[model samples]
Target: MASNTGNAFDFNLFKRLLKYTNPYKGTFYFVGVAAVLLSFFSVLRPYLLQVTIDDAIMPSDNEGLVFYVALMLGVLLLEVISQFLFIYYANWLGQEVVRDLRVNLFEHMLKFKMKYFDKSAVGRLVTRAVSDIETISSIFSQGLFMIISDLLKMLVVLGFMFYKSWQLTLLVLTVLPFIIYATRVFQKKMKVAFEDVRNQVADLNTFVQERITGMKIVQLFTREKAEYEKFKGINDKHRKAWVKTVWYNSIFFPIAEMSTSITIGLIVWFGGLRAIENDSLSLGVIIMFIELSQMLFRPLRQIADKFNTLQMGMVAANRVFGILDTRSFISDEGSREVGKLNGKIEFKDVHFSYVDDEEVLKGVSFKANPGETVAIVGATGAGKSTVINLLNRFYEIDSGQILVDDIDIKDVKLKSLRSQIAVVLQNVFLFADTIMSNITLDHPDITEEDVITAAKQIGIHEFINTLPNGYHYNVKERGVMLSSGQRQLISFLRAYVSNPSILVLDEATSSVDSYSEQLIQDATDKITEGRTSIVIAHRLATIKKADKIIVMDAGRIVEIGNHEQLLQQKDGYYKKLYEVQFMAEESLRS
Candidate 1:
């Protein structure tokens, strides 16, 4: 996360934000014109009142008074229309900009490397995508145009006051320096308060989202009381952040009101004393100055509040731009668009790490020939999963080359390379959608008939048919509706339907029951018939029939041969792993 510690009114950042309005330039210009028209209309009414008092009402001219009153009403109607258009178009433009910004932000996040997500919090990103962008919208709808419109109205009102009487206008000016100094102090304090408010909002959202997502864990471990305490602490911080803004508002508004009232009193006192002695200063002029004083001071008072809106928007824009400017995505510079790949893969001197100076794979090299099944066995944290992740370019390698069909994988287009491979993991993730939708992922090319055909081939068709609505059955979030075994079967069937040239199964059968294990094995046998396959598993019995087995320790391969060949070696890694681990499990199951 980035913190903004500079001036609140950042023009460069503001200029960058304005670029989003380029798409709706016509609306932007229309809103600007409406603001200007509103300012002009706002001042015309008070001038008409001055004229009606001096030129029509006092002289007892009935016809002149009627004409002037009618003109004043007409100006009021125009001002109302202008206000409506200004508000409507400004908000419409704000929503349009927000819609575009949200789309662009989402698309940018989708391309980021998996490593970036590994270090970032899900809820903070959600806050940026949703809540922060919403704050930026206020910049257009309330902050920018509203402030401009108010300032213009003040300027026009001041011009009319001075034209009527310089003496009265200077009296109004006498109180402004104090109000302006208070407003500046208020703005500086509010900027810091708003930044704190935004930070607290992100923290509250992150805490609540994580707790809700893992609610079962909280309850299962009897941690409800502890989690509630943590939540209360966070919620209290959020409340305190908002209260600071309210505190500043309470202090500032009263000062603004006092100054305006005193200025109005002075104008009346001075103008009244002059009107009684001389014919030059008339009663109409005094009344006009009173109305004009409010017109000028009211905006000055409200402008500080609107300026705070702009400050908050700038803070949000800074955070959003931080994410947008990140250079964490995999470089998709490959131009090779090979339609379909032949399933031959080789890792040559692959050295990689998730973090600097902490290598997970050190000069690890292996090759799986076309249409061969290679099983990789290793202990936890032994670089088994890192190999699969590297193959898919989820993260770039520090140094080495991964080749598919003798062409370097880095030279192949990312989507083209990934489309040829499929993976089914130990933990299956299914959306809160229909089973068929989860399987096809709404690929547009895949149909219900195709899914059913693939399901039957994988031997899970009977199981799916037993459920209500069959393929249409909703699998809720993370497939909680189904048992662990049933979810694994869905994942296996999903991988089979993709029909990739290479399939990687990472402990796909480890946690399931006997029935699902048998079904997954059947699906694995059917799917890996002619395609190149790489299986990573802890259960040695499952991979006993694999054409080749690679035993890894620490970060390097220590053994490579057929199952029997590796088992025949005296005190070998695989032989000890099999005898000490799966042999006991197999006996217990029997």
Candidate 2:
């Protein structure tokens, strides 16, 4: 939601953007050289016009006329070539810069702590990475290098005008200060407009993305009209934001055109009088001044427009840099390489809060010895999930010591620590890819054969083979192609193939059919045989055989024991929870 309200020309931001071009320096310099040549060739055309009229046509010299005409044609050809190079190379540099920037932005987002994503919207980030970065490409393709070429052309034209007649040149330039004042006002207004446009665009994208993602909910709840109204409101805001920019352009461009006309009128009037009064000012010189005046002032007009592009690019850079400057990365200071951990996890006196003062886990502690299956049961908001998040270091605990194999997890390399753990969430997510790819996740070392072997081990191989294309079947987005139980089965196969030292299944079988639940339970048994496993479930019956059971209530550990021991404790928290949260499942089983 941050808006850029800085100066119209932020040289600091511009300098930062230039650094991205370091990788494409050769193309960058080629574009620069092309701009210079383009300016030189452009200025040559007007000068040749003057020579053809004054020294060749006026003198009735056929030979001189032919030579000057041929020279003019050659200049035009060179200009065309330079223009092509300038356009092509500038665009090439723009594309390369944005490609690198988009990649860097995505990579940076990947390293952000889960807490950052918890507060951020997917659509807003997508806008930054896709649309805002694409707008930046125009800063080079249509803004920076074009501005340079225009300024150079203006300079060359001005030198020629002064060489011919400084008095006339000075006269034509009297309108320049007013034009500059107008352009400055336009740039400031456009910058604000552009910032609003970007913000509104992000809002629209976020709204549309969220609404479409939850379309089923909208239809099921019969809220289509309400959702449509909300979308229309956001769409209106986006439209209005764009209209403001167009309104500014509508005002600024006409003023620029009027200024240009005034300058041209001054040249024709003053140059004609001077030529009539004194033969020293030739007709060719007067004609050349008219053309040269346009050459000088046209760039100033185009610059007003290009400066808008530059300002928009700077605003986008500010937003993107804001994300890049975030210090929310989970610190990976641990140097211990966890090639293989013993899978012993102990959380000693841990406390955590997603928000500043509202703690979710309050001084809770537990230990899961290697090769043990620990089941955690609680009400919905009792922080069962927070424990899983902290164990994986997804969110750092406020005050705690989380140790794996006696070494604090904080002292282990992040990749090494995570590499040894596999998690299957209750809501399994599958990519829009073949089942094989979904299982292997494009892991370089996980082959199709390996995926098939793991699937067979988890007892889902036959189920997968029954599908249309077997393992090659596309699961589609979020694995919507498969039933919830089937997706859970695929998730289990995915974890099994990784061969992690520890496995975490957070309510992995909560919403599946009885048949799928039995299959999942079968797979769960095989997968957890010799590994440290953490099972978070609402079904007391499913976890009745767990090595240990931890009961939680309102962010506190209320009871801890094996299932039978906790169940035997009359009025114990686990017993009460089983009666409240799992009696229906127990009845269904009966």
Candidate 3:
């Protein structure tokens, strides 16, 4: 939850938001000029009515009446044109600013360390990137620019009223202080409500996103009813938060209307009495004062509303800037340029933990020479996957050195280092895109021909060709349209196309069918050839041909040897793990 300090308008936040308009300064300046012109033209309509009533109709001058009527139409036309420019340009500036902001925010998020994402919610980040940004746009369109135009309109109306007659102008403005006081109170209450609304919206998004993503688990465990109740509770909170804003609006708008009505009543009573007393007092002045009073009070009321938009935008800005200001990036100060070298990997005295004081990898050390395949086998929570994460530099090691090709991994450029390595996790994630696009990841350098060639080399090309669109087949969200094994095959093709010097298979074939398992094994042989490979698997038979086997238990390497040598030690951890973990799979395979 983000804190809201209850300030309805933060001038610092406003200034920071204004900086994003630097790219569209011409549009911003044009909108400002339009606002000023709009103010001038809007004030003329009432003034023209005053002139025509006083100087043309009363004196029965037909020529003067015709001229004043023409002038009034011209002023109305100019006001309309000014309004069109103000609206069109202001919104255009807002859209352009937010588009750039969203891009910058997403790019910033991409640089964050894996640890940051581990502690954050995908739904909340999505809310910040999409929904929160949209609200910021409204700050410029409905809040800031509109408020300025309205304020200008108010000032112009007040000036004309005073010039016409100060006594009546003063009387009409008596209700202003009350209205202003009411507005201050309304703004305070609404600020709290709007903040609550934003918080609840984020909560709702997080809840729905998580629940929908994990809906399979909910149904598998027969917990749908329970989850529905939880969702309803969150949905109810969202409803209540918005209802608070509605309550504030319901109470405040009528008060503004009553203030405007009271001002008009006071002007009518006093102005009528004054006109009766002084024969020179014209009806035009009274009518004009009524119109002018509405103009002044209407904007005051709208400012209260617009202030909510501005306040919401500031709240959103604070959240967004909070992400942008985070210094939790994995420092990439290494300047070493990656070039062709023997694919050697070494983890010397590596110690790491995902959380404070809870080590998951404890002084573990290993070496895989060029063209060697090292199989890491361990039970769940034995830190098998942690080793892969460290090798890829997804999380920084607390204290240790990870060297690749005789160079410390931390001393190499992150992009260059990762570019030479490829990982295929147990849970393969495919984007909602065509199969060809997913395989290439939209990389222009890796063309359709490259993908087809890679897929053919891996023996999945025939299966892909049987599909309706072949390479162009759309793998819907998370590749849900394809079976689990089929998705894994697509991942293999993706990795093969990258042609990395080092390949990692993190239990890649753990859950696939026998046919898919055979396909993966063949593809694995082809891809891992002439490269350093690390295979993290539970199936003992699949890794029997590896150059070395490293068995881990409780973050420590308990055994290190080839399949035959490790099996020779009857009481060793590797022998025990092989018996327990692979016995069932071996039986099923036979």
Candidate 2 displacement at residue 166 in angstroms: 1.1
Q: Compared with the true structure, what per-residue lDDT tens digits does model 1 show for residues 132-191?
A: 999999999999999999999999998888887898999999998899899999888898
| Model 2 residue pairs with clashes | none
Candidate 2 per-residue C-alpha lDDT over 1-590 given as tens digits, one digit per residue, 9 for 90 to 100? 23447457777778888999998888998999998888888777888888899999999999999999999988888888888888998998999999999999999999999999999999999999989999999999999999999999988888878888999989988988888899889989998888888899899999989988889999999999999899899889989989998999999889888987898888788878887887778778888888888888889989988988987887888888889888899999998997787889998999999999999999999999999999998888999998889889999889989999999999998999998999988888899999989888889999988888888888888899999999999888888889999998988999889999999987556578988988888888899899999989655655787999988999999999998899899989878877776776678778
Worst 10 residues of 2 by lDDT: 1-10
lDDT of each: 0.89, 0.88, 0.88
Best by lDDT: 1
Give the runs in model 2 whose Cα sits over 4 Å from its true position: 1-6, 508-510
Q: Write the per-residue lDDT of candidate 3 for residues 15-86, one digit (tens) a residue.
A: 888999998888889999998898777778888888889898889989999999998888888888888888
Error (Å) of candidate 3 at residue 262 is 1.1
Q: For every model shown, what is its TM-score relative to the native structure?
A: 0.97, 0.97, 0.97
Prediction RMSDs, each to the true structure: 1.6, 1.6, 1.6
| Residue pairs in clash, model 1 | none
